[model samples]
Target: MRERRRLPRPAKLSVEGESDEFVRPMRRSWTCLARRLRAPPLTALRFLTPPSRRRQRCTPGAAMADVSERTLQLSVLVAFASGVLLGWQANRLRRRYLDWRKKRLQDKLAATQKKLDLA
Candidate 1:
């Protein structure tokens, strides 16, 4: 796969209101061992906080939303699937009813012809 490169930003203005400074790894020895790649512009502010605390202020669950964004997506998916199932079932029953009605009418027509011939 080809890797995408970002446009070089002007030195004066910071990208995404945050500068991509050289981030020091947790340990000095580890940094020397691994070849460091250039970091991307900090578009997401969450990275500024410690990894231990994502939603809260330097601590987990200090301030979190009651429902996550995923809940809305899941509800929408379930409703759409239910609608599709109901529609498919309705079409199947409608076809069966129409076929039965056509057969009944054909039988009635055949019975009438038999009586006419006897007369």
Candidate 2:
């Protein structure tokens, strides 16, 4: 059996004010390497970190302050009208399908009756 050849380990490149623990063990792509090299250590680290979720919630009236009463009413009316139209179309299709099925069954019954009369 042949012995496996060992590959040389890549030399560690240290950044000022950054720890070795932060360095990824796996191989990084050229784009990621380029981005890290381009930006300052602090700026790069800042961008990499997730955003803080300590944002203040707006008051109930504060959100509606920008929106006018007429605009709000119009939006509500449009939503209601669209919902009604969709329901009407769905009902119409269902009724048409039921009618078609009933007609088909009646035709089949009539054909069966004709055969029975002939016999």
RMSD of 2: 13.5
Tens digits of lDDT, candidate 2, 5-35: 5444456555678676555542344345557
* Cand. 2 Cα-lDDT: 0.78
Q: Tens digits of per-residue lDDT for model 1 on 82-105?
A: 999999999999999999999999
Best by TM-score: 2
- The CA lDDT of each predicted structure is 0.68, 0.78
Residue 82 accuracy (lDDT) in model 2:
100
True lDDT of residue 39, candidate 2: 50
TM-scores for every predicted model: 0.43, 0.47
How displaced is residue 1 in candidate 1, in Å?
A: 87
